[model samples]
Target: MPNPSSTSSPYPLPEEIRNLLADVETFVADTLRGENLSKKAKEKRESLIKKIKDVKSIYLQDFQDKGDTEDGEEYDDPFAGPPDTVSLASERYDKDDEAHSEGNQFPPIAAQDLPFVLKAGYLEKRRKDHSFLGFEWQKRWCALSKTVFYYYGSDKDKQQKGEFSIDGYNVRMNNTLRKDGKKDCCFEISAPDKRIYQFTAASPKDAEEWVQQLNFVLQDMGSDVIPEDDDERGELYDDVDHPLPTSSPPASSQPIDDEIYEELPEEEEDNVPAQVEEQRKMNQD
Candidate 1:
């Protein structure tokens, strides 16, 4: 039998193919945040990651819709009535004590603790840092529950990295670029306490979809407000030409030493521009 905790498609996949997919998914999830890879490697990695996510999303939706395994076998519920009780006389006398003990041990679910996902996917969130990167935008597996926004390092991560209540928060498209570099397709969530959480989507359409979903939930919760216009987003909303430096440091920024230039291998030196352009296009995509 397949592990119940593992994600499985409603349509049966060959064991070899399924294992290969799982390995690729694990590799992509584990290496996505690493910055040590070459530009070409990074581009390929991101592309593979996107494909994996798309496949996972499709399979998950199908699994939910089908609501059964391909084998068509019915699985027994473990929560069904017990086959037998320990003792009828002991149970009669201890039922009240057991109930009281359970009540004290487990509290009722809170009103704000809705754990079902309304929307979920990958998104990059800006976080402060004191390192050379200055500020970093890191990708996370994000989910929006009823009144909470939760994030994890990966979709398969059991423990959440963090979460916040969005009861009175407002979400809007705010495409402001940071001091480090430009980030397009961005949005901001303004908390009731004046804290702002920023996130960048893979595309403008995606960013708008996230904003719309959040707006719908907020409106239902009595936050009646409209998303801000593009002009209000930021000064850099339309400025897409200039982006962060990629591949390697520009020649002007390099040390003015002839020996450094002479030491560069001919093959590596010639491919820098092409590599940079490839990375640029990947980022734009």
Candidate 2:
């Protein structure tokens, strides 16, 4: 017979058949427990026992067949497939090759004749040691294609303006000024010291190096590059007014009036000493 808890049957027994089977099972149980029967009469109970066993066997076979059908269906399904593999080494190599190729594509710029012009306005804005001068060198290279311009000025007025432009192997000072005094017409390369550095060819590729060297010199002098405009100067000063917050509350928001001391009553002051004396007496007792 199939276990009652087993889920092997695809269908249920008819109500009439179920009732008949239940009655047979009850009769078999009763027969086994009855003590009034003689030994010979108990042996004749085999026919009734066989009928109960047959009913259970039929139900059990049906349940087993249903279970087998379900298992077969699961195996026949075709959606399942194998997992995939990935190549970590190939991916890493591709990334490395890309980085190496990018590095080789660009050439370096030379220190001499850095091709660009530094705007006096821009240099003043940076106001940090070497940064202003470095920007000046970078600007010079950016402005003049492949030609480099050299500047001459005192440490105080690095933006005071005089520079010379060097293109290819040729070197010349730019000293032309506008008649209206509005702008400088020429670039300055050399100073009154007459110290002449050898003229060299520079490409856009060499801009970073030239700027670095110029910045180094400015840092050694211990001066910052300040902005040339009044508005830019004001911006630095404005920052001082708005400092970062701390744990203390803002002074303006505090309740100053609440902390002011009020006059005390004479009666209350007189009673204070009497109360203290009474408390001392109680403690002594």
Candidate 3:
């Protein structure tokens, strides 16, 4: 590694730049030393003043050393060093193109061309009971696609800690049952097994749009159905559970890209209560 003392001065130091820097430095210094500062101020003024002075030191040294450049162009910028860009020889690029053209008859198709593939990507979702420390409604990045849903602690995380199927589910806008301020932009998803998942978007429109888009995907897959547990959901879900389609997609893959959101196989992890089990048994009559 090169020594920091050997660094070249950054440039384009014209008369205008010098005057502007001087004005800024003077203004900052005056503001720092002013006696008429607000009495209600709670910030550490000393720390801010030191930070400004440190930045000014870097700029001042750079300007003084660069004051003598003949050309108007910037020279020896600290932010930009030697240009690493290089162009391949024309003959090499031409030969590579020729080889590439001799390979395939048809160009590869992209996955987004499939039918009913409305929208799919990672989105911020907040669980109802995720009150970490003292903050309410902690957000998690969730991956949503036509058939699968995944959530992780962060974007670059190695493995997802929790996930659920998007198929055979119902979605609806959040209702203010828990009395948690304005929940107009919150929504809930209820799986076939009666497990409810809640998410809040940045706005009511965003939440509604997500619910509508999810409902559309479910309809296409044949899992669109109205939910039948309004009272049960009111007791458990803080938001609301809207009716959804009751269809399931086919087993075959579609034209859409497989790399988008990897589909999760249907999981059967329902732990229905004894009352619900008895009700189902009675419904069979």
Candidate 4:
């Protein structure tokens, strides 16, 4: 083991840690050469190797720079060396912090930036009720976050009524009957859990936009678990029952005849029965 007393840097990585890092590098390299690796897997391994090399380079540079310092004297460092040297070293040599200190090429991510709103609006959610109607559409304020769909009683409501993950859910435009028996512009989020959430948008366009955004999010999440084709969807996601089609078919499309019926002409007094006429004459007399 190299003498710690000979090292000028106050926080130098231990020999065991250096050996472990080396072993990690070797393992990562071997794994990278393996066949049948996905593109994402290969990219991640390459990134790991780059990070290891960069960390090793930093320690070598630090040692060389502080070599001329007084023998057996520790250099001043901002961090107090903790017993867990690996944690301390990681903190002291954090590349992200280093980049920020030297002037970041990219600006720091803001809280809003981390989870930008995917979609937000007022939607009527079908909730169960004990009223004459088994279910009713209650308007809800909704927004899509990185991991889940959040819904509140109103836009300003801090307390969310409910939320569900988008992992294995599928979104599609589905029309359903309103209380007045008219179909509403709606969509549904169905999952393998057999729990279907239905929402009514203000308009067909709004419903379509919601579906598109949610579908895009599911696809981006890399959850190919939900199949795209409607025919194949039943095997993966719960099939929601849509009461109506997007639009009602025109009456002209029906098989009924186009012929118009003419009205029959009324008979004159000559058509009256003789017994009925005689009875009416005697009553009048």
* Clashes found in each candidate (C-alpha, N, C closer than 3 A): 0, 22, 11, 0
- Candidate 3: C-alpha RMSD to true structure equals 29.5
Q: 1-285, model 3: which lDDT tens digit per residue?
A: 233345433654464544444334333333233345664442555554444344434454554344433222222111223210001111122224334433222232223332344544444344333212211232444556446555443455444435555777898887662234336767788866545767767667777888887886677678456443568667666443544556766545553435344433212224346668899999998
Model 2, which residues run further than 4 Å from truth? 1-12, 61-285
- TM-score per model over all chains: 0.38, 0.17, 0.34, 0.36
For candidate 2, the TM-score is 0.17
Expressed as tens digits, the lDDT of each residue in 238-262 for candidate 2 is 7777776678866765555344333
Candidate 2, which ten residues in sequence have the lowest lDDT sum?
81-90
**How do the candidates rank by TM-score, highest first?**
1, 4, 3, 2
Q: How much RMSD separates candidate 1 from the native structure? A: 31.7
Candidate 3 weakest ten by summed lDDT: 82-91
- Pick by TM-score: which candidate is best? 1
Candidate 1, 227-256: lDDT as tens digits: 456686664664555665578766876566
Residue pairs in clash, model 1: none
The C-alpha lDDT values of all candidates are 0.56, 0.34, 0.46, 0.56
Higher-TM-score candidate among 2 and 3? Answer: 3
**Candidate 4 clashing pairs, residues 3+ apart or interchain:** none
